[model samples]
Target: MFQLDPELESFRNDARKVAERAFAAKAAYWDEEEIYPMENLKLMAELGYLGITIPEEYGGSGAPVVQGTIMLEEIARVCFNTALIAQGAINGPSRAITVLGSEEQKKRWLPGCVRGENIFGIGISEPGAGSAMTDMITSATPDGKYVVLNGQKCFCTGGHVATHIMVFARWGKTQGPRGIGSIVVEKGTPGFEIGHPGPKMGGRGVAEVELFFDHCRVPVENLIMAGDPDSTRSFKRLMSSFGPERVGNAAMCLGVAQGAYELARSYSLERKQFGKPICEFQGIQWKIADMATQIHAARLMIYRAATNLVDGFPDPLEAAYAKLYANEMVQRVTNEALQIHGHYGFTREFPLERMVRDSRGFSLGGGTTEILRNTIAAMVYGRAFDQRAGS
Candidate 1:
């Protein structure tokens, strides 16, 4: 077993205790109401759970990526909604700010983020483009001291409530990924309209929405990274900081499956059937064993991907492997968990059905499993494989 070290295990235990005590009881409320967890964010902020990865100077604990993931996994075991919030607080969008943002930019934004006062979201996938990053047509045209944005972003995971956003846009009239870059858009900026919230099957509390930047103008200093019209280097550098998003996503999946397994285990021991507890049956026992074994494999892969890093970031290849395996592994483990509960699993009265729905989104959110396979193949071959027509 590739288990956590003593210090890390203790850290994990602390986070688990907080998660089990604080978030578990409220999990159902967030899901059933389908409302944003404002209280959950405040509580995490108060406990310093929201900013473990941010530097101490920025009002964070400056914890390593592994530790931040511990918090995400623990929160996810009880409440996937809150876990997503913490995911952004510690990883994903936060990394982009720290890794690529200028000192002035970090100073202006990161402290509020660490304090949970500011929520940051990412806007990359647009209506015409998702995995085909190069096909995006969102434009960012430079003016005297501002850049005018003219495009829309869809499936924006946190756009509805985010205090600030980083939207990828084409920097010039040029085509392809080489001209792709990103700029920050604060909420309530004129010409930047957030469309109505689009409810999702799982991860209900946080709403996804479409963002329209109709000649939206933001300061030139807000340009986080500018695309080099000549090379794909700028876009690639921006994505490298996104490793935490993929890894944290895997951790959430791991925790969700772990929660399901725990529930099934308890149920098997208590529910009497065929003259004894269901756990006594070899068939049920085998299912339990399989779930645990598979979850363990996924956990090991995620941990390695998170812990072994270059420049404090998980490598793209490692993240693709962990995300893909964990994404697929979550589906199997949670489904089998639902199967163990039989009829009750299908009902809304229990959390099994909810867990299943939540697990399904993991594969689709960060990157589709199909897209990840393509990423993996390219890495393995040490060359970019074009998926375009007539290449």
Candidate 2:
């Protein structure tokens, strides 16, 4: 069995209490009305939950990455949408800055983020670029002391409400991943336009939008990589952040699955069919057993990946495996849990329907399951193998 240290276990307990009290109460209203849970977010920040992994020098708790993952898992168990916001609030632009930003940049952003005074977003996927990020057409042209940005980025989580966004763009004439770099774009920069929130099947409160940068000029200091934008070294530095991102995403999936399992387990015991409770039936009991087992397995994988991050940058292959497995595992667990609830599960009266919708998106976000498989295959085979070809 996997275990957390006493300190971490205590922290997890505290997080679970706060999540149930603050996040769970507002989950349904936010999902029904598509309202952001600002109050819950503020409460989390005040309790120091929002900055679990940030260094104390930057007005944060300086906790390990595992603590942050534990907090996310607990929060997500109650409200996945709120958890989505927390994920971006803690691990999105703030993390990008920590990994790639200058000392001055960190000083300016990290403090406010920890205080919940600033909201940051990440802009990576474009209409033309989704899985193949290197195919992005967004370009940053050098013009004296500033760089002019011209392109559009879609599916920008938190874009509509973000105070600032870290945008990935092509820095020079070079093509593919080598030419890509990240830059910070403040909310009101000239010629930068953020569109209205796009529709989503789940994660309603967080606004995913399109960003238009037509001759958007930003100071040269905004450049994340100061040296050799076109070099492989710079690209690798930015990609290094993906390990944590994947781990965080996996934790969210694990939480949703766990919450659904608990609901199903309780309903099975109390909901009697014929004479005794349905849980006494062999079929219902078997489903509950499978759900509990799978959730335990997924949690172990998520924690292993999160702990690996504490020592150094997590291994990309390990992160991918955890995320890929947990993401898919949530879908299976949620579905079985819903099945246990019968028709009641499909109604808004219970959270199972919402859990199902929310869990479905996990396999598509962070990194698509298909894309993650290719990553894992490359690592295992020592070369990219074409899946379409007959072995």
Off by over 4 Å in 1: 389-391
Each model's lDDT:
0.88, 0.85
Candidate 2: the clashing residue pairs are none
Candidate 2 stretches with Cα past 4 Å from truth are 226-230, 310-312, 385-391
Clashes of each: 0, 0
Q: How accurate locally is residue 243 in candidate 2, as Cα lDDT from 0 to 100?
A: 81
Please provide, for model 1 over 140-209, each residue's C-alpha lDDT reduced to its tens digit, 9 standing for 90 to 100.
Answer: 9989999999998998876788988898888877777797888999999899999998878998888899
TM-score of each: 0.98, 0.96
- For candidate 1, the per-residue lDDT at 200 reads 85
Q: Could you tell me which residue pairs clash in candidate 1?
A: none
lDDT by residue for model 2 (300-382), tens = 88888887753345778888999999988999989999999999998999999989988988888778999999999999989
